[model samples]
Target chain A: MKKRAVAYLFILPAALVLGIFMFYPLAYSFMISFTQWDLSATRTYVGLSNYRALIVSPDFWNSVLYTVYYVLGVLPVSLVIGLGLALLLRDSSMRGVGFFRTIYFMPVVTSPIAAAMGFSWIFHTQLGYANHLIDSFGGEPVNWLTNYNGIFQLLFDRFGVELPRVLQGPSVALTVIILLGIWQNIGYATVVYLAGLQGIPQTYYEAARIDGANWGKSFRRITLPLLSPTTLFLLVMFTILSFQVFGPVQVMTPQGGPLQTTSVIVFRLYQQAFAFYRFGYASAMAFLAFSMILIITLMQLKYIERRVHYD
Target chain B: MTKRHVTLAIKYAVLAAGAIIMLFPFYWALSTSFKELRDIYFEPYGMFPTNPTFSNYISVFSKAPFGRYLLNSLVVAAGTTFLQLVTACLSAYAFARMRFRGREIIFFLFLATMMIPQQILMIPQYLVVMRLGMGDTYQGLILPYAATAVSIFFLRQFFRTIPKDFEDAAIIDGCGPLRILRYVFIPLSKPALATISIFVFMWSWNNYFWPLLIVDSTEMRTIQLGLALFRTEGGIQWGEFMAGTVISTLPILILYFIAQKQFVKGITLTGMKG
Candidate 1:
């Protein structure tokens, strides 16, 4: 009875918070999505128009393609670098391990908006540091941000080849946003991976080594499998985060400009909601985006949960 | 022993390189903040300033009502953290040691809410906030913001792990739930509370979007919105922006440094899994 009392008391605030902020907003957003209500002007019910626009709109599809491309550009490399750092730091015998971990996690604590500004300045072609470095190497300062037509063209260029401009998925301005996203979040995923590394027992490593397993072999066969759960968690998180990305696009690609190639879905949603005050239209868009995220993340949740191995 | 040394050497070298790259951007942000405008741009990679000036910092405050913004943010952050911890503690204790009907279902339902993005709810939440007539008020800022599902849930989870006998003993001595919590659970849960409070404080301080929607007047602007005003202000003064970032980021950075041990421990313990 006493324990029951304590338990009820304990869950009360979190329950209240979840009820008011999260649960209410969720149900209310769904309701808002169904109605043509922007709240700034008079709201009216126009069921399914919002959902219909999702399938028909070219911009919506393009945003979807661009978001997927951005995820590819950032999330995979983020996992690799993060996992690499976690592996690198796991040897507790190493000196200054704590300090290294601290420095690595610092970026996670810093504001993304501020970091976006820094990256924007760094990537500026004319007077930017990147251009300065290129000049020092006797190379021409190529327009990194302006020249990319879309994703396909961008891929060809990376392979030191050229493609027709039509094949590209995202613009140069948007690519910078993607790269900066990876850089900022790699630290975060790395910290999470480091904690996950704690679950692995040292005896396994020693036994593997005694059996004449090389470092690469141990990492591939043992570490990789063990770290799958963490990787899955990170993948789901990154996918959701990718879909809702706004800040970098806001700062770096102000109108998601350079031919609207950088304009992501969330940025578009913000423009419609706040800037245009087309709350009803924006609400429709918001809900559509929300639904897409929900479906995708739900799929991910199912996929990852099955593979998750608890040690 | 020799193999161990080799592995350790490799670990240090790789970790050191990654750490340097990770920290370089922040170092540059701080260095540029102190730099004279000409040096920052003309020699972009220059790690040190030829001439440092406090003028940028002065301009950040003088050109805008930054002091007011900082105070506004501090009040909101402090108030939210205070209330969140109190409510979270009460609720956490209820879930931890208390026998309750529908405990598992209610708790799981609450946890399920965490998986959804807050963006989905923006319009409706805004409408609710507007309807409440709490716009531009501290009560508006503090009350709505205090619904910290993460903290309360985390606290509740922590409370469950603790042995129930301490509370039982205290109760047998005629202590009430609140008193038992005051003398017993509070002491043991200090680390968890500190961790939760710091994050809640940081979240409240750095939150821009929701506040931007609700906070109508310039005076009510938190530091984040105040800093973002640079986005629309006089020149897109990159120098001033760096300066402003440096100034605003310092207090939190300093606090984080002081509390880093607890912060890291908290994250490692609560953030890794359930």
Candidate 2:
């Protein structure tokens, strides 16, 4: 009993704080999802109405679609770029690798809001450097952020070929945001991949070379298979981080982009709860978003655990 | 050149190109922060200012309560880090060294919460804060972060690696659990504690989403929130905005430089075990 009392004393503080902040809010958020409780109004029970309403709500669905678009847009590109950088810098013979690593990682440590502000300036319509580059290339300046139409559709439109709305790709606004996501995350992925690369033994590559495996063949047979765990690790971390991407959207395009093109689920949740004061509805949206991320993480963990090799 | 030399050249060329792309925005921000508004507007593609000025930095300080925002951020970040360390150390010690019933279950519960991202709890947590009348205060900003599952988990892993001899000796000297933690575990786990502290500090320092929700007053705003406010309220004053960005990020950047190893180790550990 005395031992149990001492143990409880140590655990009490963290459990209390987490209970108040994490576990209780989780339960409360679920309870609030079934009610209509605006911040100022009386609570009224509405059975599954909030969830049912989301099914038909275009805004809610648009948020989901944009979020999925962001995940798909940022993940593979950053992973490839990160792996490339890691491989280049992973050679023990390489000099100035630490300097390059520090340079690549500077943005990751910097404030995302500050980074977004800088990016917003980068994509500024007229005075932006991106448009200046386009002008130098003998091309028309692009309004990167304000252009609400899909990039593919816009490209097709330039040729006077009208494609169906359904076939249009991610909006220019979302494309810029996706680009920013890739930029911000590639450093993290590179650093993680570098650490993983350093862990792999030199003997594996030596043995492969002794078998007369060429560089490309060795990379395919040895590097890819060996790096699967790191890849899986990054995928899960990036998925969760990507799902919670709110700062950039909030700072750069506060109104969720022109025509709601960049209305990610977290941004939508923020807008609903705080901007519109629809607590109950936003709680339902939160539950849905949470469940979506949870399912993805679980699926990835199960799939990767079986496939990833320790050696 | 030989094939190996050619490949090495290609690798350097690729890394150099990637580095340029990664570093350009930062260089742009720094350059633009120094340029006059006329240079920014008239010479849109100006890579370097012809005549740099401190006018934007002057403007950033004058236009808002930037100093107060900096103070607020410092206090909140420090407070959160301090509280998280205290709570995490206690819990980590219990989980690492204590022999008691339901300990595994409790530790598992803590670990499970690590997967529950902050977005899921934001609305309800906000409501709870408001209900408790803690809204618009530093406590509101710092309280929710006073305990972190990740820190506890990380510290517990570190504490377990410290050999049992030191802890046993401390206990034999009539030291209590907390005393053993103070005298034995803490002295040995400095690096891990430092890693967790830096992680907590940086996480809270750059935090935006929660502060945006809770802190509505001008004086209560964090530096990141202050920058956002400067962006929207001050219009496309790129010069001042970049200056604010520099101000907001410089401290953390310096910290990163000073503690680069801890930051990298913490990040890698977070990736693997987080």
Candidate 3:
């Protein structure tokens, strides 16, 4: 009993935190989600109406697609780059590998909102340095955010040789945000890969070299296969983080402006709850995003665990 | 070339290019923030200015309550880190060494809550704050973060690695839990505490959404949110925007510099291999 009391003391602070901070809010959000509550409305229970509206709303659906794009656009690109760096920098023989590793990891620690603000300037269509390069090549300055329609059509057609005139993909504004997302997050994946790489005993690679296993074969035969667990964890975490991406959209591309092309699900959720004062609908939208993330993380974990070599 | 040398070259080449792409924004922000309006506006590709100016940094301060925002960020970040360490240490020490009923289940529950990505809680958390009338208050912003699952879990893991003999000695000396915590456990776990401190500081400082929901007062806005407000000041103040970016990112970068060696070692040692 005395030992149990001591153990209970250890767990006390965390339990108290969850009670007041987590569960209370969870119950609070659930209660708020089923009502006619807005900034001025009464808190009367309205059954499934907010969920119904969310299903029918085009804005909600736009966010759904935008949410999908968040996964496709940022996740794979960052992972490939991160894994590639991991392979390069993990080698002890590589000069300046530590310097390069620090540089890549720097952005992950930088504020995402600040990074987005800086990117907004970079992708600024008129009088931005990015467009200035294009102008030097005898091309007109393009409004990256304003050209959202053209981006989708252009991307689907295997990228545009000539910029098209249809709204699609992530808008120029959205692209800048995506770029910031990619930059801030790639460091995390890279570090994970580096850690995994470090875990692989030097003997394996040395043994491969002794048997005349070439670099390409050694990497394919040894490194890639061994690094599966770290890669899996990265994928799962990335999926979760990507879905909850809200701050950049809120701060960097507030209002999802330039025709609402950047209306990601979390942004949409915020707008619904706070801006539109549709608390119920916002809660439902939040749940929808939560469910999508949960399903995706589980799927990735299961799929990757099959190939993960624990030893 | 031997296969080893060839692969090494490819590896370094890819890493160099990748690192450049990752860091270009910082350079761009610095260069643009110093250029005159005409230079950034007309020349656009002005990577460097003939005469760099401090006007952007000046304008950033003049434009808003930037200094207060910085203070607010520091207070919140410092408070969160301090509180998280305290909570994490106490709880983690118990989890690491205590014999108690229902301990595993409760710790698992805390871990489970972490898996529930925070967006799901945003609205509800906001409502609770609203009901409690903590909107726009620094305490409102700092209080919830006093306990974080990740920090606790990491701390507990580290505490487990410390030799149990230390605890046995403390107990022999008639030292209670808190005394052992202060003198023995704390000194022994300085590494774990430092690692968690940097992490908690970084996350608390960069955290935007909760601060956005609760801290509507410009006086209490964090540097991250203050930078956002600076951007909304109705002008394309590229100079100041970059200046503000620099201001917001500097603390996190500094924290990284000081504790990074310990931070990296902690990550590797903790089996956070992910």
Candidate 4:
């Protein structure tokens, strides 16, 4: 009984905090999602109207589309570049490898808001370094943040082809935000990939070499297969992180950029709850975004589980 | 041998280029922070500042309540880190050592809370905090994050790895559970504790969204929120803005430089275990 008392005492503080802050709030959020609370005394139960409105709202759908564009734009490109960087720096015997690793990981530790500020300055259209560089190359300056045209549509237009609205890619402004996401994530992916690379036994490569495997052949046979778990981990992680991206969007394009093209789900939710004081509606959006993320994560885990080799 | 040397050279070249690209933004921010407004807007701008100045950094403080923001951020980050460490240590010890009733079920419950992302809870949490009269207060900022499932789960895993002999010897020496945790577990688990501490501190420091939600007054703003607001309010004061970025980032950058190993280990541990 004394031992049990001690155990309960040990767990009490954390359990209390989590109960009040996390679990209770979770339940409360679910309840509020069905109501018409606007930070007023009255919270009338509305019964699925919030969700119904979200389903049909073009703004909500646009936010979802932009989020998908941000995710698709950031994920594959970062993975490829991260893998490339990991391979380049894999041999620790090389001088300055640790230095290179530190440099790459610097942005990972950086505050997203701060990094976004730096990026905004760098890509600031007229007086930014990017435009300066373009000017030096005798190329026309691109409107990075203010441009609302979809990049793919722009490309297609140059060839006199009109792409469908849904087929248009992320807007130039959203693409800039995606670039920031990719920049911040590549370091983390590289670090994780480096750890994964280390776990593969040195003998695997030696044996492959003895079997007359070339660099590309051995990499395809040995490296890629073994890195699948790490790849899966990064995929799920980046998806979740990118999906929750709000800081950069808020910083670079405070009003969600031109035409609200850069407004992600979380940003839209923020606007609804705080800016518009529609707590119940925002709660519904939150649940929807959460369900979408949960579904995507579970799907990834299930799809990747069969191929993940424990050995 | 020449071919191997050539490949080695190519690898170095590629690495060097990547390093430059990675470090350029920071370099530019730092360089721009030191340049005068005229130099910042000068045509055919020089790569390096012609004449470095500390005036922009000085103006960053003078133009806003940046010093107060720094103090607020310090208090919140330190308070949050201290509370998280206490809660995580106690619960981790209980989950790892104590065989109480409903132990596995409770542990699983705590783990399940990890899936409840902060976004879903923010609205209700805001209401709860405001109802409790904690809005724009340090408690509102610190208390909600007092017990994270990640820290508890992390420290529990760390505690389970420790040898049983130490606890056994402590028990034989008339040490109570609290004493064992204080003397045996904490003393022996410095590196793991350090890892968690650095991560939580950095996370708390960089957190912007929560503060944005709770804090309404400038006096209560954190460095991140302050820097962001500074960008909007300052409006094209790029020099001062860069200076603010530098100031806001300096503490974490310094911490990272001092404890790079812990930062890296934290990432790997969380990445793999999570």
Interface RMSD of each: 3.5, 2.1, 2.8, 2.3
Question: What TM-score goes with each of the models?
Answer: 0.91, 0.97, 0.93, 0.98
lDDT of 1 at A219: 90
Candidate 2 CA-lDDT value: 0.88
lDDT of 1 by residue, A131-191 (tens): 7778989988857667546656755877887765435656766777888887777877887
> In model 2, what is the error at residue A87, expressed in angstroms?
0.2
Off by over 4 Å in 2: A158-167, B234-236, B272-274
Among all windows of ten consecutive residues in candidate 2 chain A, which has the lowest summed lDDT? A161-170
Which window of ten consecutive residues has the lowest lDDT sum in model 4 chain A?
A302-311
For each of the candidates, the C-alpha root-mean-square deviation to the true structure, in angstroms, is 3.2, 1.7, 3.1, 1.5
All DockQ scores: 0.51, 0.69, 0.62, 0.66
> Could you give candidate 4's per-residue lDDT for residues B1-274 as a string of tens digits?
6999999999999989888888888998999999998898873257888888999999899888899999999999999989999999999999999999999999999999988878999999999999999999999999998988888999999999999999999999999999999999999889988998888888889999999999999999999999999988834489899999999999999999999999988866665211
lDDT of each: 0.74, 0.88, 0.78, 0.91
| CAPRI quality band, candidate 4 | medium
lDDT of 2 by residue, A73-146 (tens): 89999999999889888976688888899988887788889889989999999889988888899998888887
Model 3 bad stretches (over 4 Å): A1-3, A39-41, A150-152, A155-168, B1-13, B263-274
Clashing pairs in 2: none
Best by lDDT: 4
Per-residue alpha-carbon lDDT of candidate 1 for residues B111-183, written as tens digits (9 for 90 to 100): 6766666677676677777788878888777876565556768888888777878888898899977788899
